[model samples]
Structures are given as structure tokens and as C-alpha cells.
Target: MSDILHVATRKGLVSFKRAGNEWRANAPAFIGQPVSAVLADARDGTLYAALRLGHFGVKLHRSDDAGASWSEIAAPAFPTVETPDDNAPAVDMIWTLVAGGADEPGVLWAGTTPGGLFKSSDCGATWSLNDSLWNLPERKDWAGGGYDLPGIHSVLVDPRDAKSLTVGVSTGGVWPSADGGGSWRLTGTGLRAEYMPPDLVFDLKMQDVHRLSACAAAPDIVWCQHHNGMFRSIDGGETYSEITGVKPSVFGFAVAAHPSDPNTAWFVPAIKDELRIPVDAELVVTQTSDGGKTFASQSDGLPAVSYDLVYRHGLAVDRTGSRLAMGSTTGNLWTSDDSGRRWTQIHGHLPPIAEVAFG
Candidate 1:
């Protein structure tokens, strides 16, 4: 059996395999289409790819034999607007595609741009809009973080309870639902939005969470990379505490948690808000083994003078916690088999990377 990494980019999907100590990326798939999200279910070794076609909106595909072959599935679609408005909510991108818990086999979730969360019971065959979230009175206040519409960039399903979930939106703060995706409440109590007025920074709905990762050892321990800084939550989604001591810059787009250690996690720091490139013109992945108490930049053997910016889901850790893969908006892909202590570029100059996952 070989360890594989699937990278979704602005142009297509790229697959890589571990050969000896290095990751070797293969030819691109879904050529010419922008692939936004790629996930693989370890339970059955099935791969899922989310694509964004220039003129055709969002699409999804499933591969049972790894990336060898794929079949198109029923894509997620929003219900017609009742107000006859041209600006009605429409899905322009599927920012996240996640599999449910191990016990919940065929269940899957798709987080789409314009802020819609969809669920599918039979893999990616069909979907149902979480009307509860769509009709929520608070949804009217949902705004875009940087794009023209809001998007659900992160989705976390409780490892112990598939019925409980947490979602992170661009401008809309993180929200948690105990009864699956039914009723929800904003859970950004300790998160901050420094972009707003000083007095409004702590508003429950004001935080801008760039990426969220859960510690596999403890589902409640979450690490968040935010627009302004970094944050952590030990009580699940109840509250968060800012990690104020991270070096270089506090702002970043991606965070990855150790698969079996709640206290260990990683982040890729970029320049602060308004400027989103690597700090000091060098790209580094920071790691913390004592929860969020401290962080250290690990960039040995990696590019020293670089200005690459990774997307929110561009960083991912394998189940063993011994491998790391990250791709950048500049179309550079790097991997580390020594738990991020050293890195090597396996692919480059393809297209802007949207997401990366290890399978």
C-alpha cells in the first residue's frame, strides 16, 4: 500500500505517491477545470473531488479506484428564491467537501460559497440544503470576507458524535449545532475581529476564521488560523483564546492538527491582514506541541527566499501525523515526511492550489 496526496488546484486535481522518502506527483486530472476541494475516505479508500467550471457552476466526482477513474454525481444546488430576485443565493463554489464520522459510512457534507451547508446520505449522489441555516434570521447578516459572497470554508464533524458539527464561514463567525445541522448558534465568544472598531472586535458574529482543524485525539480541542491572529478552543466551540505569542506574524490561512495528539498542531504564517504572503519573504510551517502555548517555525531544506501564499485548505496532515503536504497559490507543492522538520518540492508551476489532502 502506498501513501498518496491529492491536491486540488485552479486548473485540476493532481495526485502524488510516496516513493522512498519523497512525494512524486503525477499528471493532473479534470484538466482545464478549477478543482477546489479534494477528500478521501479512509474507510473505503474512495476519493471525492469538487470542481468549479468557469461557465457551469460547481460539480462533484467520485473515484472508487483511487484517481484511476471517476463518475459524476448529482451536484449540490440551491432552491429557487421565492422573491423573484436576480441576486438570489446561488452556489458559485464548493469550498469544502468533508466525510462524516467512521460509523456514518455513506454520509458526506459539502460547504458551498454563498454560505450553504448541504448533506448527502448516499455518498455524493444527492444533497439537501440545511434549510434551518438558510432560513435563520442571522443568515441575513452574513457577508463576504473578501469575495463577493460568503462561503463555508471549514466543516468539522465530531469524531465521537456525527450528530454534532461545527462550521466556519468567511465573514460569518463559527457556528455549532448539537443536533446534527438542525439548530445552530454562533460560537465565536472569545474570537476577535480586529478589522472592526476596537469596541466591536469581540462581537460574537464578527470573527473571521480562515481555517479550522480538530485534534484527532480530542475532538473538542480546535486550532484556528484567523484573519488577524491564531486561536484555540479546548471546550470545543464554547469559546476561544487567542494565541498571542506566535512569531513572525499572527495571521495565516491554514492550520493542521496532529491526528492523535490534541496538544500538537501546525500552522503556515503569512503577513498580517491586508498583505497575505509569507513573512520575511520566506515560507515556513510553524508547529506547537504544547497546545497553543508556543510555536516554532520549521523550514529546513525549504525555500528560503519565497513569497508563496497558501489557501485556507492547502495544508493537510496524514493519519499517522508523520507526513505533511502543503500547496501554495503560486502553484508550488511541498511535502515533508519527517513530520515537517524538513521539506521538498514535488510539484510546481501548475495552477493556484485550492486544497490539499493526504490519503
Candidate 2:
């Protein structure tokens, strides 16, 4: 069987497949619509794509035979406004989609802009709002990072326990739930909010998490690429410890954990928040085989000088711990089949990519 990679972009969704020792990317799907997120579910090999249309609103598309064809599903929608004073938030973007556990078939989770979490028990055919998280008082204080509304960009569900999971928000900090989507509690004791004053940096409901990745083998081990620095949660995000020693810079958008080993992971470094481009305008993928103690920059076949900025969902590592794929805002796509020791640019000149997945 060939290893296939799916890329979600501002323009559409694209698929890349391996051919012998090389790879090739297919034409874009969902043309014209900004595909915010995509998931190639491993449990049943189902494909789900989230799109943002300027005219109609948010949409979710699904494909059973990979990307050969797709059909639209019932996208997550907010409850009808009960009264004129109702504070219902509109859905802006479907930031992330995650498949449920092995025991929970047809279960899928969606994280959206305005910080709404929804779950669909029948693949992507329907969705139900998670009011348990939406009614929290802290939701009102959560502000926007890149857009006018806060978004739940990273939803890390434990493959072992579908009911227990963690989600990353731009200005809302990290929220983990123990009883599926029934209820959630927020935590930021270890992570910092550098954008605020020193005294207010550690205040509740104040965190900017760009990306979050948890080990599949050990769900208790969580790795996060925060807005201020890199962090690892040893107790399933109950608390995080900052890895201040990450060379170059830990302020980045993407983080990928090893499928089995909880110690090894990958990160794509960018300049500080002020300069979102690659550090020194040079593109590199830093990896740490020994946790976050030290990282080695991998630029074997990557661009020499680049200014592309990879979004939070752009980096993905396959199950075997062999294939890695990432797409940047500059429309460049790169993949590595040997644990990221080397790389190959398989596609370029596509739209600003949003997310990457493999199946």
C-alpha cells in the first residue's frame, strides 16, 4: 500500500502519493473555498475536510475513497438565537478535526472559531454542539489571536480513551475534558502568556497555544508549541513545564510527537511573533530525539533561504514514525519518509496551506 498525504489549504484540499522513491501531489479539491482543516481517519480510512466559504458559511466535506470524490456534510452550527440579548457566537472557521478512539467507531470531533467544540458520532454526517464547554464563564474572556474571534485550533483526543481529551485555544489557554464533551476545566499554571504584563502573565484563561500534540502510545505525555515557548505535559496536560533551552526559538506554530516514543518529537521554528517568517529567513525543521533538552535542525533538502510561515495545523507525522509532511504559507510542500533526517519538496505554488494529514 502507498503512503498518501493530504494537504488542506486556503484554496482547496490536495493529496500527495508516493511513487517508488519519489512523490507527487494531485490537483486541488474543493476549488475556491478555503479548506481550513482536513482529517484522514485511521480507524476506518475516512476523509473529512472543513471549508470556509465567503458567501454561505462553514462546511464539512467527507470522502470514503480517499480524495477521489467528496460530499458535503452537516457542518457544525450554533443554536438559534433565543432572544435579541442572546450572546450566541457565530462559527467562523473549522480550525481542526480529530478522529475518535478505536472503540468509538464513527466518532469525530471538530474544533472551531469562536471556540466551539462539536462531536459527530456518525462520521461527518451530523454534529452536536458541546454546550458543556461553551457555557463556561471563561469563554467570555477568551480573545482572538490571528482573527477577530478566538478559535480552538488544536484538539488532542487520546486514542486510547475517546472520552478524555485536551484542546488548545488562542487566548483561552488549554482546556482538558475528562468526561468526553460533557465538561471541561481550564489550566495554564505552567504555560505563560508573554503578551501580558508579568503579574498578569499567569492569570487564568490567558494562554496562546499555537499547536498541541500528544503521544499516541502514552496519552499522558503531551507536547505543545506555545506562543511564548515550548512545553511538555507529563500528566495529560494537567500541568506543563516550559523547555526554555530549545535552541533557535521555541516560539513556533507546529509540533509533532512520535507515534510510540513519548520523548521524540518535531517542530517547525519561525522567527518571533513580530517576524512570523523563518528565523534568519532560513527554513528549517528542528527535531529532538531526547525530548526537549536539545534539538537538531534538519535542512537536508529544504530551501536554503525562505520566508514562509507554517500555520499551526500544517505539520503532521504518520503512524510508523517514518513519514513527515508540512506545507507553508508560501505554497511550498515538503515530505520526509525517513524520520525527517532528509526532505523532499513534492509540491509548490498551491494556495496557503492550512493542515496536513497522512493515511
Worst 10 residues of 2 by lDDT: 80-89
Candidate 1 has its poorest 10 consecutive residues by lDDT at 139-148
Residue 336 lDDT, candidate 2, scale 0-100: 88
Model 1 global lDDT (CA atoms, 0 to 1): 0.87
lDDT values for all models? 0.87, 0.86
For all predicted structures, in order, the TM-scores are: 0.97, 0.96
Error in Å for residue 103 of model 1: 1.5
Model 1 earns a TM-score of: 0.97
Instruction: Write down the TM-score for model 2.
Output: 0.96
Pairs of colliding residues, candidate 2: none
Those runs of model 1 whose alpha carbons end farther than 4 Å from true positions after fitting are none
- The lDDT leader among the candidates is 1
